[model samples]
Target: MAEDFTPPISQMQSTTLTDDSIQFENFSRRVLIKNIVGRPDGGVGLAGKKVTVGGWVKTGREQGKGTFAFLEVNDGSCPANLQVLVDASVSPLGDLVPTGTCVLVEGELKKPPTGTKQNVELRVCKVLEVGPVDPVKYPLPKTKLTLEFLRDVVHLRPRTNTISAVARIRNALAYATHTFFQKNGFLYVQTPIITTSDCEGAGEMFQVTTLCTDAEKVERELKQNPPPTEAEIEAAKLLVKDKGGMVADLKSAKASKEELDASLSELKNAKENLSRLEERSKLKCGIPQKDGKIDYTQDFFARQAFLTVSGQLQVETFACALSSVYTFGPTFRAEHSHTSRHLAEFWMVEPEIAFANLEDDMNCAEAYVKFLCQWLLDNCLDDMEFMVKNFDKTAIDRLKLVSSSPFERISYTEAVKLLQNVTEKKFENNVEWGIDLASEHERYLTEVIFKKPVIVYNYPKKIKAFYMKVNDDEKTVAAMDVLVPKVGELIGGSQREERYDVIVKRIQEMELPLEPYEWYLDLRRYGTVKHSGFGLGFERMVLFATGIDNIRDVIPFPRYPGRADL
Candidate 1:
């Protein structure tokens, strides 16, 4: 039989508990004193209202005559803080109740001393210690805690004033983003985490595979794919050279079609010989071959699978159908980079708009960013104040700038010209009209040149994504990157190519297999409209909003190179 539980009459009594109930709830043995702000109603302020509250002890001042412990208690409901004053007679707590010890304080709410900014302080009738706190064990000491040190102790960092404040501000910014998108009539779409296509096409991906990897099975896969033919081998070598510094060899290379075919035939024979050798080695190791090379195809998919670097391409497809859609999820990148800003896994918010050009994308990105800043400032006053006092003094100023002013916009050509003339810092890669802007160059442009967020557009075609629409001059692609002062390359986007033939040509020229991407190509084959979207690094945005410098601190469980701790 299940037991029926009931609360005691004493526990059910309405004692008019206020926010200060946290001061002495469980720590004190007998009566718990709570200091409250005011009446829960819209009646008179703390002066005329009879109320009881509790809070945590922020600081305790014990002069010989009387012990006045300033209790900073919160009901965990609102941002408001309630202070409680404990007389020596009532507070037998002495040194037992340290900072962070939850306590309940009960008293009539009364105004503090003239110099005290607080409106009311409870003259405690009782002080109860709900829990004991050890100051030495807590990371949050009387002195301010640095964000760098807090990175090593992420679990407990949120309990501190600074981190708690950041959480509050981040929550506000997130709320603002959702509200903004909702108001604009955009549908939120959840994109898949594990994807087959390498969206960025950079080929720098963290592979995902669950296929059998026994010695025999691995050899079988090699036999099916076979090594490159002599001609194919030469082509692969050339491709490698082109990516590296082998300009002379590439310039001198020349081969007829027949000669290339002959070389490929010879290479195929050589690959067959190598496969036989591998088979023999596997047999020597007493492993059985699953199937003959001629009988088996490649193991599974057309190509290997990997974590998606971005969700832009997938969302762009939905945008064509839904007209306006956005994907907000985790994106992976295998850069092997160890930086404060880069994360192996980070959340990316990407929104695609059909029939929208690069200009429309810029408008959306700016509006979205500004909307978040304004929302945080309005809803998270306490958190903002905490950050201003402890972390970055310019935090409020930056937020205000984003909310009030228009973002700076400049073409890539003009930006390159400006960089060349500017003497602040010299870049290794010459700032030419055609080259890609490195992260350093972007930071200089936004933090130094513009002194605000800047959108650089129309990058050289050779450097941008394959689907970007070509400019009238045919020299550049209709692409844009929204660069922030501290966070470079905050958003990367472009106006996609709408013409079917042009996209097909571009795909063929790249030499990537087309059979797998038939569906993607069909978008162009059928009705296609001008579309554009940008990927915002969610962690970087959180870093900016909270005035925290490290990307690792923003994520709850950070996954970086060779590090995953649960």
Candidate 2:
């Protein structure tokens, strides 16, 4: 009976069989538009195949005197849209001829007539579903949009060519990051989002506390162990009255001192219980404070903590034992910058290596940056080209140059002298020997002077973080910064100070409190090795690879001053 059973094909939702048709999950009963059209030949080879596809109509118009409609549909797999022809009888042409209207239909793939734009066209036979759009209400139109304008409608910008390509490019870069680090034998470590170490600087971090959260906690506790009600307090007072009356009776009857003392003790106990009830009646809900400060012990972590600006300190603990380790995650900064380059929240790629020094740090940074660029060139060239056509012309060129060219290395002092010697250009910041180089100076070294990626090392000890290894001159630290053409300081790194007393003195000289760094110092006190590490701004990598001028455009959701849109 089972072998003889045959199922009837439905006319409502039909899909014809073809040997070459692209297959997708059948719950939606549709295939991705990418599979049907994104091919080396624009899917010309798969002519006459029957398949179902779903996508938002990028542009649609009624043709042939309203008898039929031509729709350009895209599912965001690639930039190209598939040409679709729908008859008026199959579905309402009015609904299908609006921009941003979602259409899912089953059709036969046919080769288009000669001299047309598309190689193949879909002759839609069955209109499975239609999501009508109000053309006037839709923010995205056929007109080109500026990057700044796109930020206003960020939720809808991904439907555009620029943001969608950025999404793909970002995905490729993230995948490449993990692949490169994993392939290099670096163990991936997820450092804490909330951390205690202020490696960058104090007061620049977003402090993590339970200020409001603990107040709610106190409210919950008060509800569970509520204050004494009026009725309960009255009953306790009545008990005290009864005890006092007994004590008075004992005194009037002139009873033995023991009896009188016993009555007095009962009265005292009743009054003490009443006092406790009265105290409970005065319940208040707020964050407990000690010495005019919100007590951190009552906070979530039981001490002051903050969103980490960098994972360098925590990942170093892992690198000491594992030999090499890297952390990739979002870091937060409370910087009040409204610049195109700054974000309140951004991603960081920090890698630490044991048994490495300043030169090793520079080499590691260079190789990592090169690998990221090459990865983009190999995997996301299509998206890169899209950016090249739309946003930045030198995007792909920049990627190729970084991937193929060797980076030039120079010392910090030498770089400063070089910048100072440039009589043609005057830096906004003074180019002194001890002063930290500004973005202009860095760009001069990389873009103008070297015309390639430049690694500047051995920065002033006073300007560098206390963790950096002090050089023999005792005036500078073993630090390095990888500067590129557009982004001046792409990566910053250093060989860590391994000596305990030297670092302790360095910490003191910087006027930093030593309590927060005890655990970091324990790595040096117990067993220390020559470890070096650097942090690469992951968003900057996206910026570098795509040649996008603004840092906010590359990330999916940009968080900055006065803006955190969903």
Candidate 3:
């Protein structure tokens, strides 16, 4: 059942690629450093082959009495850096000896000296380009930097060993995600970034509107031409009175036609000036509103809109028609949380199945997750090594364990009983039947109790979303969460409630407006087939795979409450 993209990945599982069968060539004419250094032989076998390479220098030092320069260049194609030897005649040693210098050179791949860590070295024949660095102004040095410092200089952190590997791993995972779903006969669909409906029914959504910009526009205009003061308005009014008197005098004296026209023009001009000043003075800086409420009619969308918290609802629409569909896109939440687990904006992978139940949903989730773990092991061991050396030592082993082990399935009630029965360790949150499971509870089950991934299903309806299918007991919903070590709940899913009357009742019981969801109800009203779907926080997958601690580090740009810097 494997697809075309499967063989290369599968082949990579056993041995390192030494052939052109798996290439990471970029569109540029220059060859990727990965294609050279990532080989089992580390380009030593390709000696005497002339090639062009482009990258930023991680460290450069002049040697041989300034006759040549040795540069450790990394193009971020891989975690490894290629050792480049540039002659003073081919390129200025000074220009190439800086930490952040950009170097593009045509060189012959040669074997390095015996006993060196590197297997291959580049002998440059000619310098193609050079972007010199001001070493004094450069922020990153050869010294070791803390992760907190890296976060502050996120713009340049990619050049570091850690972040670049993270970037590559992230790229591979994203590619693997699309490949897995597409190979499984699922269509990739795009859901909206701006939505009118809150799929989670939680009001923690970032409101998207133009009202703030509109208010800024007014304030900007006033700043450029400040509003007329009360004294200025009075002066304008006095001018208007004087002009009226002059016009009246001209009419009474039967002045010449030219004088009468001139007087009338002056009167009109004065009146307009007075009116303008009065209006300007009355202008108060504030958001325009009506009836003491935000006039959303003046907004960009002509109504209240928000950055989508999840694409599940929209993807479900596609699943109804396409049978199998998935959406991977950015989702936002306005939760004012400052924990390592929360991000204001993050990505989500939501898949909806037209004819699947809770069991099928669990099967799909398990398969997809296992595939991701195996994918990393097969393709990203090089980058994972970097993660291990720097962040977490158990990163690779965890991946292997999850990829090979079958996730244990248990009922939510059973999991609660297990937590309540724990005698060795105490939980901060009390174990209860109706309460939603917290991260500590989840981690305890996966890490302490089972020591493997676990699926807890049949959550209490009151603690779950309204769209979850009600169970036979009428108290629980067909909801499931896949929890794992390091990270707690990695995926949340449920069998959707497809009955129109039941959904309407549920919506009413939750005190949500039915008008906004009329279209959703129509799906059931017309011809609803049983469906199920799940939402996987993309960052959580990256965190789990990389064993990175903070949710912010895995993503390229972390957006939290006070930090959205690029």
How do these models rank on TM-score, best leading?
Answer: 3, 2, 1
Q: Candidate 3 lDDT, tens digit per residue, 470-495?
A: 99899999999999999999999999
Write down the TM-score for model 1.
0.71
Estimate, for each residue in 268-384, the C-alpha lDDT of model 2 and write its tens digit.
999999999998787669878899998889777899999999999999999989998999999999999998899999999999999998888888888888998898888777788
lDDT of 1 by residue, 1-566 (tens): 88865554434454654533322233222223212333342121445434455545555555556455555665433445666666667866565346666776556667666887776666677654466677789665667677777767777666666666666666676677678888997888888776777666677788765344444666676677664456655555555444333333333465566655565565565556555554544432222235542212233443467788888778877998989888888889988878887788888888889889999999999999988888877776656766777667878888888788789999999999989998867687777777788888998998898888999999988887678888898888889998886677888888998888877776666665676567777788778888988888888887776677778877776778876656
lDDT of 2 at 235: 100
Residue 148 of model 3 has an lDDT of 78
Best-to-worst ranking by lDDT: 3, 2, 1
- lDDT for 458 in candidate 2 is 93
* TM-scores for the candidates: 0.71, 0.87, 0.87
Alpha-carbon RMSD, each predicted model: 16.8, 6.2, 6.3
Highest-scoring model, lDDT: 3
Candidate 1's C-alpha lDDT?
Answer: 0.70
